[model samples]
Target: MSDLLARHRAVMPNWLALYYQDPIEIVSGKGNRVVDAAGKSYLDFFAGILTNMIGYDVAEVREAVERQLATGVVHTSTVYLLRGQIELAEKIARLSGIPDAKVFFTNSGTEANETALLLATYARKSDQVLAMRQSYHGRSFGAISVTSNRSWKNNSLSPLNVHFLHGADRHLTQFKGLSDAGYIAACVDDLRHVLATAVAGDVAALIAEPIQGVGGFTMAPDGLFAAYQEVLAAEGILFISDEVQTGWGRTGSAFFGIQNHGVTPDMMTFAKGLGNGFAVGGVVARGDLMDAPHAVGLATFGGNPIAMAAANATLDFVLSHDLQANAARTGAIILDGLRAAAPRFPIVGDVRGKGLMFAIELVDPETGAPAPALAARYMEETRSLGLLAGKGGLYGHAMRMAPPLTLTEDEAREGLAILVTALENIS
Candidate 1:
């Protein structure tokens, strides 16, 4: 191990995972690529875990931060009214698609989900929440409580009583063999059964990721959440869409992943790409839920001027460039290429995802069992070949790729070539 790695282990928590067997320190980045401390460049398909939406060192975001820095007043608690915060809030509210929507900023997606949970519980007067199985929220206690992935769930105790539901991972699920309509019907029936028999009281809310991020970019069939929404609404249960990984046009077909399901969530949490690598996240909801808590509440450094500026600039860049359309175009090419190559590689059990957020699930060729070791080997091979991808899933058998929305056809094809080569050389 390098000296920095040794020091990192000494100082940081052992649970914080890092990629690569010989982890390289990424010192700088430009466009879609990053340079390590050893000056090795890699095409950053992970994009800082999908946080750098527009790409590294984006000029607009940098200038926005610089302009805010010029003001010399970066940190202002939520007590004071700040122009940048107000402007950004207005932008988010308009784009949120909720009537009379209000926004509350946080420093990260975990905090955003935390705030959402508080609102859901307080509004509905219940501590019982429903979460999807094979889902990942965040690392914080409250976030982890709802997380269904065993590897990410560090503890069993939780403030809220969370019931795990099906429908997140279609391929690895019992609904795998069913047709699209059959799958949706079965999942809906299961949800109805859970609510009827299991939940003791009125359920507070149903929180779900439109696309399971840390669960390896797994997505449920279309209209699955819409089906759940109908059931939840009948029981007065709030719908909370955790858009941390699928928000801001990353999914291509829709501005928010939940939109693809054809239902408007009562509350939505966003982070990761919103600030373009800056620490910014927030919850957007109707006015009633926003004011549900009667007591005083505030996030000390949540809506700081610098973070708001970065987010506003990032949103502007995303819109002006029509990156959502770009994502749809480039993502289709990459997805088609991968699907075409999957037949040649028997280890690839599935190729799935929308837009730039895609994954390839590795499985044992003969038995069709989850092949996590093969996935790990493929990751290491890709790293050595100057490509960076992400891994996740309950079995750690899925290779995740979520490049910047600005990915060109050439870059997408290049990365695809490397990925194919990595798979070919896996044996």
Candidate 2:
């Protein structure tokens, strides 16, 4: 075993999973590629688990961080009025789409979700919350209660009364083979029943991920959430869209994934991608909802100037360069490539996703059962052949490709080709 791996295994928790039979230690990166300690460069399909939105060596983001750090004050906390923080908050509020939206920054997606939960439970005066089966919010005492991915939820006890709904394909298996409209209606019916039976029309909120990130890029019909929101609104249940993975035009069709549903959520939380590898996350909501708390709520590392500077620059780069449109164009090509290749690979049970966020489900060729072993083999093979993908699913049988939104046509096709070769070898 490598010395680093030995040390990592000895020190890190067993649950802190690393990829591949022999993991590569990425030391430096540029564009959409990273060079490991052994000097092997790989097309970074996962983008550090979709955190590096604009990719590495971005002069704009680096310069902004440098410019902020040059003043020597990295963090003054939220206690002080900050120019960079205000600038980012204003930009986020405007783009958030929630009427009279107010932004509250946190250091990670988990904290952002925790803040949302606190606000929701407090405002509505109920601990009852709704979440979809096979969804993942974060790994926190409060966050895990609402998160339904079986593998990720470790604790049986929870603070909130989180009821898992049949929101998407995993739990809505009975809706399979139905038309999109029919499937959506079925999910809506299931939700209404759950609210009636489980929460008794007194739920605080329904937290949803427009695209279930750790549940293997699982998404329902676009209108499903809109339908659910209509019902939740009738009962005064706030809708919290967890945009940690699907935010910032990752879905291609919309700036925020929930926008595709044609319903504005009561609140939304975001973390990854905004800082382009830096830790910056926040919750944006209706002014009334965000102001519901009677006590002061502040994060020490929230909206730190350096992180805000990086985020402001990254957002500017994402919008100015029209990377959203690029994701739509390049992602369509990659999606097409996967669909065309899937028929030849028996282990590939399904291919789905939009924009740069995509997934391929591996299964036993003979029984069509979830094949997590096959999934690992694909990851190892892909890394060996110069591509790094991500893994997650209800059963850990999904190979996810969420490259930086700045990926070019050449890079998209290059990554796609490498993925197909990996599939061929693994299948």
The lDDT leader among the candidates is 1
lDDT of 2 by residue, 1-427 (tens): 3999999999999999788888778899999999999999999999998999999999999999999899999889999998998999999899988999999999999999999999999998999999988889999999999888778978789998889887667433577578878887888888878876767547899999998999999897889899998898898899999999999999899999999899899999999999999999999999999998999778899999999999999999998998889899999989999999999988999999989999999999998989999998888899999988999889999998899999999999998899899888866
lDDT of 1 by residue, 1-427 (tens): 4999999999999988998889889899999999999988999899999998999999999999999899898888899998988898899899889889999999999999999999999998999999999988888888999999998877898998999898975665576679878888988999999998899978899899999998988888889999999999999999999999999999899999999999889999999998989999999999899987989998898999999999999999999999999999889988999999999988999899899999999999999999999999999999999999999877999999999988988999999899999999995
User: Which sections of candidate 2 miss by over 4 Å?
Assistant: 170-173
Clashing pairs in 2: none
The regions of model 1 sitting more than 4 angstroms off are none
TM-score of each: 0.98, 0.98
Question: Candidate 2: lDDT of 350?
Answer: 93
Error of 1 at 155 (Å): 1.5
Query: For model 2, how many clashes?
Result: 0
Residue pairs in collision within model 1: none
